[model samples]
Target: MLLCGLAAVVSACGEPAPRKTGGTGTARPGDRVTAASAVPVNGGVLVDLPGNAQLLVVQPRPGEFRAFNPSCPHVGSLVNPPAGGVITCPLHGSTFDPASGAVRKGPAASGLAEVAITLSGEDLVLA
Candidate 1:
């Protein structure tokens, strides 16, 4: 019974579903994201873009925004948002920088992929 319980916990924290790589590093050009819609707090908000791509937008400094693909490079797991500003992969303990998307710990050798975006009229647009 204990073994079965452990397996359940492991499976519950398994890797994410496979992602389609159509637009991995880029958001759709001209797509508008309102600031109020994505209130930046610890870890940042998960934004779902067209084509099933996921983005993590973190404002480390006031009025400064950084965006990155939230997928863990080690095994395609969807990295969880920052807890105390540290982005971590729930599956295998990989960690990344929420601001610069740099690799902080392993299992993931590479950092998260950056996604370019620009500010316009209180909204962030894909660049």
Candidate 2:
């Protein structure tokens, strides 16, 4: 499991990290996030948004994608990307479902916030 996480990180090092937008406004609908191919099948990638926000974009299956705020509801810590079918918070051991962002286990009483996204050709656009 640790190897998987490390592999994900190492692989991402070759891709362009999400560019930090200078605007203070929150990401709007129709904004381009990242290429769909950047998200691996049954895995995820972290994307940086304008207002210091972030999204965890996961592909639970080929041709289907889901996005989440990736913030642990317990204390607002950033959760790790899905591994072994679970999205986990490193700070407090909160676990969320990769596909639905539902709480699987938690000190958190709530689940990760879902963010809508749409695939535009090869791009994943915020929706």
Specify the highest-lDDT model's number: 2
Give per-residue CA lDDT, model 2, range 1-127, as digits (tens).
9999999999988967553422213889999888998999989998877776678999999989988887788988788889999999999899999989999997999998888899998999988
Backbone clash pairs in model 2 (N, Cα, C under 3 Å; residues 3+ apart or in different chains), count? 0
Q: Which ten residues in a row have the lowest lDDT in candidate 1?
A: 19-28
Candidate 2: list runs displaced more than 4 Å.
1-25
Model 2 scores a C-alpha lDDT of: 0.85
Q: Per-residue lDDT for 6-113 in model 1, tens only?
A: 999999998987664313334457886446347465447777666676677777767788777777899888887778779889999999988788999998999998
Q: Report lDDT (Cα) of residue 70, candidate 2.
A: 77
Question: Over all chains combined, what TM-score does candidate 1 have?
Answer: 0.74
lDDT for each candidate structure: 0.76, 0.85
Candidate 1: residue pairs that collide: 43-82
